[model samples]
Target: MTNPVLVEVVRSGFVESVHRGALVITAPDGSVRFFAGDVERPVYPRSSNKPLQAVGMLRAGLTIGDKELALGCGSHNGEPGHVEGALSMLARTGLTEDALACPPAFPLHEPSMLAVAAAGKRRAAMNCSGKHAAMLSTCAQLGWSTTDYVAANHPLQELIRATIADLTCEPIETVGVDGCGAPLFAFSLTGLARSFGRLVTAIGGPERRVADAVRAYPWQVAGTGREDTVLMRNVDGLLSKGGAEGVHSFALPDGTALALKIDDGAARARLPLLLATLRHLGIDPGDEAEALAHNVVLGGGKPVGELRVTAGLFG
Candidate 1:
């Protein structure tokens, strides 16, 4: 059982593509609400595991500021605000962008690039740089070597692996390379959800600062156009994180966890499905649901093309 959802792209009256995947929702008490396909099949958690990684950083005695905490869990858009925040984090620890291990790239938000270019900068401004920077800073704090920080054999990686295993309550049996060249682990969707649940639970138990930081600076945790930040903004006492290739996770303040993996990586369907699942679990997102349901891009405060979800898979 690979993907249970039928994904098709029919544009201009022709089916252009198709995909498959699964989604699972669970209650706070570990009861399943809805499940499709192999919900328990192991998969790479990807960037969705950032918040949980932040928990490891916290437990390692990293007293990061709210902004750093957010960066630890973020896939930031590399906007000026994001770069400034990352630089501030490095500055606080007597480090610089040169200390980061992530490859240089550009901002995820197009608007941010204009601002960054206008400032006469040479750095690529990639969003994930902040996460890499946080990793470097944590390694620095822990007396670990900055060289080979991204290597799977690094001490930091060992700590991260141990932390993830502890949170998921499942030993990692597979490892893959991530976009930033870091090692990614394979775990079931349920294991990822349970990992997040444990992270939320840990935040309340002696690691309250990590939770406080994520909640206090949700924007830095993802970016302006990211679902994690939007969901966090819309829901009270809930934290959300999105991963590459259509992976996502959300945790209720009380430890309820929801995780999803969209086989095709059609990001448009991710939030809507999550919203529907959350609603089924008694979560209300108000007007945010509209934004989640449709894409209304505004250039000059007027309507333009919209990104719509046309999936009939639920029916």
Candidate 2:
């Protein structure tokens, strides 16, 4: 069945736009508790899959400290701290940033990027640099080639693929190139949610270790004032990650997970949908809706309208 229209862009007292999407909520046992939209179709989960991949690195004997582990699973905002953590991982392994395969980009934070541009530098501040650094470090530690480490068929990538399959409890259907030039696995949203659930609930494996690091260093997961960090900071026993193209996944300590993607890639639609989904699931996350209020509609540089769930859609 087709996914429902999950959000509408209301502007000037009208529904100016619409966003269709899929959502899957799964339990620790990989049971589907609730689903909406095309949850069974396979799609690249983008950076939301970082935690799963990071756990694979952990299982591969990749030893990293607290902040480094967080960065391994982060789409960092290029803050100085994040950059230091990423570069430090490379340095500890006697590697350099030049060894990375991901393309260089400015920091995601506006001020950081502005400062960087003012200094005539667009260095390896891309959000995925930490992940790349960790991947390269893994290869170096294992005596694998740093060259072509980003290749889909590389041994390093093979380990990651197997890890993702194990976490999601399903075989992958396709492989796509992620923005960071690493191979991305295409899997069902149900599988995505289940993967996150498993990560949160792992008994004593690499999954729990990685999840613990991310939860402890929430700032590295995104950045100061970022939604993922804010939500993770406020909500107890929750791990949240968002991806490019509107993909997002979050898990509770009990291993409940929700994964979703907005069809048109409307990132603005995600927070409200998250609020609605949380409320629908009977989880009262105090001040979370306000924490995400930055995405509210505006007119003439002032408060105008607000985005809300369609009446009774989550009821």
Candidate 3:
């Protein structure tokens, strides 16, 4: 069955388009608070899975400070600090950016991208470099081969897969290569929300460590002006992460959690839908989040319309 429309694009009072997707919101008690579409079907959480993977890294003996840990759990915008941070992780392990497995690419941040263009594409500037560097460090520390660390059969990846299963309480349905060449595990939206909830509410251990690091170092988790950075910075006690292909996930200190994936992979639909979900849960999310929710449709370089969640989806 097809997923239902979750967002609509209005252009000058006309419904210009729609985005169909699935979402799940879990209460602190692990009950489904609200959901739309096939919450049970397995879908990739993309970079949204980073926080879970960070926990896995810790469990596997990866040693890094909280700031570095946050960077490891981020799909950063590759600003100067982000690039340097990843490099520092590599430096600690007696390695360099050349050890990274992800393909060289420009920064996700516009100004940084321009700056890096002069040096051409570099692996350190890729958004996933921090995660890759962390994975390599984990391998180096455990005496595993860094040459093929991104392989699904790599010891680090194996541990990560197991960790994801443990936190989500669901076996991975499929494994695919992610954009940055890390192994991607697919699981239900319900499972995704549950994992985030577990991370936030854990009394101790790696889960809480990961959650705390992400919340405390929001800038490292994303970067300037990014959705995850903006949301986490403005919303107290919130852990937010957005991924490739329109995947988004966040958890509150109270263990409430939400996860979603846009069917068409339109990034524009994510924040609006998330804000609407937050409002449904009676969370204000502050003015910055409200402003970011407006995915303006521009005509003649001016705002003529906007993308918004379909009315009544939350009700």
Candidate 4:
């Protein structure tokens, strides 16, 4: 394993917390150009792994438009559009929210959570609803069992697992349940970056379809003002997705890929670290990085300090 990178430091007038993590950048041909911290070890990619899973469903014969595809690959903000999209996916499959294996939960977006709670809606509005709905529809299309779709040993899950393996070009290490109840694999950070590279640079096929949907409907993939949304919308030919426990992944049109994880699970550190990583990659995010700095430290509701990448991150 390589040495860990000092990716970020939190400050409230002074250094408050430090985040140590690894980053792996791979070319389309699977050559590692930059390696930081333990890329050889397995990390739970969380929702950053969804695009590969979405393309997996595509190969499994799931049929839908760009909207559904975008939502299928998203960690949505649980906005009304997101909920409607999830419900619509279910509607097309002749199923209901009752079939979803994920426990009922509120929206990830605060305002939408308030509205959804007031309306007494739960499961269908959850952030993972679209992915759940996608899995259900894939089962419907493939004649697989929808009951216990989230189970680790389900045939549907096996296929999804195979897809991850196929894209990463590596065997699975271990399996665990995602926050949304779907079975997820422990994948190496280098493998994660390579898989994302494969997805974004894929030719005209299911992979391209997933990538195109993400680029075309960036909002559906996240939501208004969200980091992924902002980055995809404003940055040319950039694809970004963030996952729980401080996992972040992005890819370029040319198949440049980067995957990073914060050891402390600080979401605030992910973007700043990402911007610095991008700088190392020679891509300038320009004003978009500045615009997405909403995670600043607040003192009495006024901005006091900032979360930023530590110097010499690549050291």
Better structure of 1 and 2 per lDDT: 2
- Cα deviation at 154, candidate 3, in Å, is 0.9
Instruction: For residues 18-115, write the lDDT of model 2, one tens digit per residue.
Output: 88888888977889988878998898899999999898888888878878889889998998888888888999889988888888888889888887
Off by over 4 Å in 3: 1-5
- Cα RMSD for predicted model 3: 1.3
TM-score of each: 0.85, 0.96, 0.97, 0.94
lDDT of 2 at 230: 83
Question: Best-fitting candidate, measured by lDDT?
Answer: 3
* Model 3 weakest lDDT span, ten residues long: 1-10
Higher-lDDT candidate of 1 and 4:
4
Model 1: CA > 4 A from native: 1-3, 6-19, 31-33, 118-124, 206-208, 293-315
Question: RMSDs, each prediction?
Answer: 3.7, 1.5, 1.3, 1.7
Q: Candidate 2: minimum summed lDDT over ten consecutive residues — where?
A: 286-295
Residue clash pairs of candidate 2: 3-37
Q: Write the per-residue lDDT of candidate 3 for residues 145-236, one digit (tens) a residue.
A: 99999999998999999999999999999999999999999998899999999999999999999999999999998899888888888888
lDDT of 4 by residue, 1-30 (tens): 667766444556787777788888998887
Which pairs clash in the backbone of model 3? none
Model 2, CA-based lDDT: 0.85
RMSD of 4: 1.7
lDDT of 1 at 101: 65
